[model samples]
Target: MIRKTFAAIALCAVISSCKNERRYDRIENAKWLIGRWENDSRAGKLVEEWSTFNDSMIIGSGMFVTGTDTVFSEDLWLEQHGDSLSYFAKVYGQNNSRKVEFKMTSSTKDQMVFENPTHDFPNKIVYRHVQDSLIADVSGVSKGQPKTEHFAMKKK
Candidate 1:
């Protein structure tokens, strides 16, 4: 009876460890982000475009225009390495050469969330697909106060 009890406890430990492991499907989760998404705001007209480069990678570009002037732009990448997915951004004019990375925390068919607690401005990034529209939200703490920004985008 003691031998059987030990075997059962060992099996339970293994199963519990497996359940605690993180499992991610980065390619499948990123498939919905492909194509162009745009929005017009007081700052300007913002556009984001995403394309699939391979099974494990998606590339993105963003541009902001005000009247006839191009104000801002950035390059982004989503990639899966091993069992984790990371989101990277390289914005022009500010740290353009180095890419800031955010680690993906959760993903579903229509939503994906990433987080980087060490970042100054944006610690969390979330993307959601609702009906025909897509939503992007960024949130973080600024000077011990919480701040969040949301952008509603539509395919173009």
Candidate 2:
């Protein structure tokens, strides 16, 4: 009986550690996003910059500029929370200037998808790394109509 109990406890410990490692690995896999990315188009210049904040978090900033005027900006964060990873965005002049939370629902070696179904718009956000570029997609229902925006940016 004593041996059986000890074996069970050891197995549980190993399983718990593996779960934690997998959670942390999600953040580690996003290390490719730790750089500056930019997209210049007829509409404006979109810029996104990301950096490591700590062992389990990454901080980012995004901006859209037209000519010499700054039109929009936002603060971004990707953080690990226990068994999950979440994405947070605090956009200027939006949601009463409060941060919105999106839980990571799917991930791969070079892609991650976060979703917040309760949000007014952009219930889904996806980030993908391809070659030397990053592609970001945001989509959801707005005004009872579906809308989606795609951004392809090169590492700067």
Candidate 3:
């Protein structure tokens, strides 16, 4: 009976450790996003700022400015819950100003992707870091047509 008990305890320990490792890996993989980025164009200037909220959370803000007028803005959050990572965005003047949650579908050393298929648009959001630039892409079906937007920004 004692031998069986020890085996059970060891198995539990291994399971718990694996869970923690997964969570840690996700948090570590996204740490590179904690910085300011910007993109300038004749249409407007886009800026995104990110900071560490805690060991398991990162907070961000983004906006677009055109000729001193702010056109778009949003609050963003990347958080780890248990062994899962999620991205949340609350865009001003959209969806009653409520936050949308997207589950992390894939992550790598320089890229992370999130998805929410139920959302009306932008069912997928992807972020990739390459050299000195950050690329963001959002895509989904809008009004029965597939659409995608891409934003490329330099570190600021």
Model 2, span 46-109: residue lDDT tens: 9999999988999999999999999999999999977699999999789999999999999999
Runs in model 2 deviating more than 4 A are 1-23
TM-score, predicted candidate 2 vs. hidden true structure = 0.86
Candidate that would win on lDDT:
2
- Model 2 Cα shift for residue 77 (angstroms): 0.5
> TM-scores of the models, in the given order?
0.79, 0.86, 0.85
TM-score of 3: 0.85
**How well is each residue in 8-53 modelled by candidate 1, as lDDT tens digits?**
9999999987754533356656788999999988878988899998
TM-score of 1: 0.79
lDDT of 1 at 96: 47
Residue 85 Cα positional deviation in candidate 1, in Å, after optimal superposition: 0.8
